[model samples]
Target: MGMGRRPAEADTDPFSGGIFNLNESFSDRIGDYLLGSPNLSLPVADETFSLHPFPVAAPLSTTNQETRASNGHEAAEGYDMGISEQVSATCSCSSQIVVTFEMVEISLHLVTAPKGSPGRPSQAAAMNIEEFLRDHKRALVSCEMLLGCETCSCRGEYVMLVISICRKLLHSVGVMHREGLSEVQNRDSSRERGGLWKLDDEDQAGVLEVLLKIRATRLRRLVTILDHVVTSHDWPAHRSMTQDLVRRLAEA
Candidate 1:
């Protein structure tokens, strides 16, 4: 191909003016807006995170200090109260446990209490007998005193005397069936039983006369009980004693 006189010139930047325009530097217009210097005019950054001069926190005001102190004191007081409540709860639990254990002990003791031995008289029964013996002896003594009074005209006293003597005779015979005669004899060594005379030979007639006037039924009942003691098992020491006492009363 035949060569032309010249080829077309290379494309050039209009802003650069020409391809050899090396005297002007390549200035970035966008970089000026994106990465500006510190002195650039713009809105201020928040002081909280700003580290240019190392952020200095603002000092607390007087009101803020007082509020913080009050909050700390309240927290300490609450802690102390919590400790006291915990201790009280612990003490209450301990006391309840102790009381429960004591009650259980008492219940067990009651359930397992020992029984009294057989054949032996209970303490309460023995006390009752002792009281009865003393009272019976006293009644006999009072009847004997009334029989000695020749001037005493109270019909009630003569009736009580008759009843007392009959009761003693019957009791003397009855006691042998309950226990050995030896036990009664040993217990009543100092106290006279059926042997205690209600009336002397002279007084017997008067006592019998007074009893007859009161009621024939009462006198017959007494004679019947006395006959029973005197005739039955005539060899027993109590029976012999009752027989002697009955003989005196019947003689008049």
Candidate 2:
């Protein structure tokens, strides 16, 4: 799990609420708003259209102080759990775009294991899955087939293939083992950070449902997360409900 380049703001990556600003004593705190985009505002630049970023906040936090206290490991677990839920919502969607996004996020959850965790094997498998998801996402970057595939067949040139954006910090006991992800890997993609987009409601939920279909075990966890996100939208993040369901899974 040794990636090349590094992200520009790797140190400042927002795992919790410290990255947003809402004037509620700390950051933006856009958890509720991000959970379900009522009116998404995507920007068009240089004649290229794409989805927007995750807004000015995270959709799974409350107090900025609490976010500060929680380290990357805890954040990784919580975020992965949340992501699982999102996959379920889109599992039913038949769109390739939605399916691609869900795969990318699930891949992120699998690959983003930090160092020092006793589950290195699990973490390695996760990274491999993440790489595959990214490749799949890249294949769908441009409406025109970037790669020769059954769905699309278009030659390159005068093409604005922005591709996909995926990121995660694998951690274990507060240490990030897999480093140097931002290196100059892809010839087309100079930096480690590639372009990403904020999916709309139907697209977002549709993507989740597709993921659930691929991994049935995810359905239960995703339901728990959906209920939690809908309940308060103003409480601290937790996966206790989902964890209870997963207690039955075994390494066997």
Candidate 3:
């Protein structure tokens, strides 16, 4: 009879279920699974467990060597590893980024005195100029309403209103003259080059021309009315006031 084959050894690896040794106690198998047997290589087994730190890791020098070898760089053999470590340390310490911003305001048409020493306008003077402009505009509107009113039959009241508005307008003009803004001395200078006030000379001239035409038309109307009142004997009390209004309008 042929020799019987030697019995196969039992599988001792805890990873494999102990099927060869069915008589083994459950507690014994569980203890071996938790503590591991001497036959098992702990380093190799540790690889299967991810929660624990690595049993063996590559050294920094070795990793750098492998990187240099793989990259085929111009670094010479046995290059100092401290250089890379120093660079990494520096970058880690001061890696933050910062930015800065600033805001400024500028004006092109800032007003200044025409006759005085070249200097910026004072706050009070600027406010006064603005007030004058506002008052002039208001007076012009008031005079316009008074002149256009047809319901008011009293010509004396009309003359008084017109005279009051004209006085306010003249006062504003006086203030402007005192502020060195009414008639700038360099008004006849080259249009290409001028101070801040003269920068928009052409536009101002156009506006002034239109206003002058309106004034001439209004004066013609006044003369016609005055002529009619003079020739007619009715409303004799209104003659003097009408003449005074006419004179004020002409002066304005």
Candidate 4:
């Protein structure tokens, strides 16, 4: 080698190669852009990951404070997401390649302050929320296969999106003609009544403790699901669904 020789300059980023920031849009984030999503068939969970949401035997409790916080919710902060059912996964040694399955929640909890801001959960809202959460949890889940990085993340985003939409439906349609404290109890007669429902804690604290631990496999499932949505152009159909969810959650 010659002395004082300089190294050659590369034209692309090491992590992303030349693909970084080439496309910019919600759709791009999910599919055809850097994610390389199929750009088709992402609505149904079945076309991406192999696992789909399944019904829970019993409804998980949402009366606890810590749990609410982990879901990025606060009473003053408005809407929140709770883990009504966290999905779990396993690995298949049978293939001799260490394939994995993801564990995530098939169900969620959406609590609404019926009487407006600072309103305590009324009998009805509480009752209704509980029932609604359980019913939605019971809805079946399914999935397909996928293979990509950004596409995987897009899949996760879509999964988050669908769940968000479902929660919004609960608030607007789940409890109608209900407001304030009365709303809470009537819907969830089983909830421990007459206690303060605290709503000011960061997510990932003690909030997620009740559910089983999340793993990469489960996250993989999420990515796969979102990728399907992005590639297949399901966002158009999911537009209102996700928008409503964002609106309601933002209110809370």
On TM-score, the candidate that comes out on top is 3
lDDT of 1 at 189: 37
Per-residue lDDT, model 4, residue 38, is 33
Q: Name the regions of candidate 2 deviating beyond 4 angstroms.
A: 1-94, 115-121, 129-252
RMSD of each: 62.6, 21.6, 49.8, 21.9
Clashes of 2: 33
Where does candidate 1 stray beyond 4 Å? 1-123, 126-132, 153-157, 180-252
- 1-252: candidate 3 lDDT, tens digit per residue: 132322333335322233423221222222222221334321221122222111222222222332244576422332344354553343211111000000000011123333332443544334333333323333343344334433221233343445444433443343444343433332544534322223344444333333323333333354445435333534444556556656755565
Report, for every candidate in turn, its global Cα lDDT versus the true structure: 0.31, 0.27, 0.34, 0.29
lDDT of 4 at 191: 33
Q: Global lDDT for candidate 3?
A: 0.34
Among residues 3 or more apart in sequence or in different chains, the pairs in candidate 3 whose N, CA or C atoms overlap within 3 Å are none
lDDT (tens digit, per residue) of candidate 2 on 78-109: 22332333433432211333344555555444
Order the candidate numbers by lDDT, best to worst: 3, 1, 4, 2
- Give the Å shift of residue 109 in candidate 4: 18
lDDT of 1: 0.31
Across residues 28-108, which tens digit of lDDT does each residue of candidate 4 receive? 122211111233322221222223233322332333232234566332221223321221112111111111112112112
lDDT per residue (tens digit) for residues 57-87 in model 1: 2322222121123555332111232233343
Q: Candidate 2 vs. truth: CA RMSD?
A: 21.6
Ranking by TM-score: 3, 4, 1, 2
